[model samples]
Target: MALLLKEFSPAELDRIIEMAWEDRTPFEAIRHQFGLTEESVKATMKAQLKFSSYKRWRQRVEHCRTKHLKKRDDSITRFRCSRQRAISGNRISKR
Candidate 1:
């Protein structure tokens, strides 16, 4: 899993970390975009973020109702924010 994560550029890694922190983005979306499982994402977060930050993120995720599709409200749909540009080839477009 470390090797797989190492394959990504710094920009991609940043985006993965960003997505993981977003309340509206589910683990499935990260998996779809980065081919990382939830555990893999957790590992990445733990390795990349400071210990305190990682613990905070874990606690937030545990309580974030929108982080999992099953736990999210049905009215909410989509992964990215409505105004965000489309991501292509794992790159987020700049406005």
Candidate 2:
């Protein structure tokens, strides 16, 4: 199993993982609610779920969620800093 760098409550962690597994629950949706990145969500999944399930889920996400990738790129961001920082394909674009 993968290790998480920080500890989370059972309920909080469970909800995040459950949301990650939902088809309608975009990474953006999770971020809007939790302020976590897609990488964070995937790391949480690897840490909490079985390896096979994680693999299948990643495959499903890559194949089925292309529109989300585009939408995620176009979404607005609000960071506490003077300017928000968000990236797509290593290029930074601000709202």
Candidate 3:
């Protein structure tokens, strides 16, 4: 697992974890952004997080339609909320 994570910086790993926890961010998005497959993401999560937290995350994602591209509705294209402001300097603005 260390070998798998060696490529990512701490900030990038944190971002990946943040993306993984989001309900609407699909594994495909993570893959596209980080080049980590679904299994790799799962493994990373398992390695980095507490066992309980990992289990909870696994349970949450197990059957979630929004976490898988094929399971998501075609009409729902964007993952981020329309009202959400972009992050700048690691701070998300309230617009």
Give the candidate number with the greatest lDDT. Answer: 1
**Which TM-score value belongs to model 3?**
0.85
* lDDT, candidate 1, 1-95, per-residue tens: 66967799898899899999988899999999888999999999999999999999999999999989999999997877887788876766677
TM-scores for all candidates: the values are 0.88, 0.61, 0.85
Candidate 3 displacement at residue 59 in angstroms: 0.5
Over the stretch 1-95, how does candidate 3's per-residue lDDT look in tens digits?
98989998899899889989988889988888788999999999999999999999999999789999889999988876676667543446676
Q: What is the lDDT, from 0 to 100, of the residue 41 in candidate 3?
A: 98
Per-residue lDDT for 66 in model 2? 32
Question: In model 2, what lDDT does residue 67 have?
Answer: 18
Error at 21, model 2, angstroms: 0.9
Error of 1 at 53 (Å): 0.2
> Per-residue error at 74 for model 2, in Å?
12
Candidate 1 Cα errors over 4 Å, as ranges: none
Model 2 residue 68 CA deviation in Å: 1.7
Best by TM-score: 1
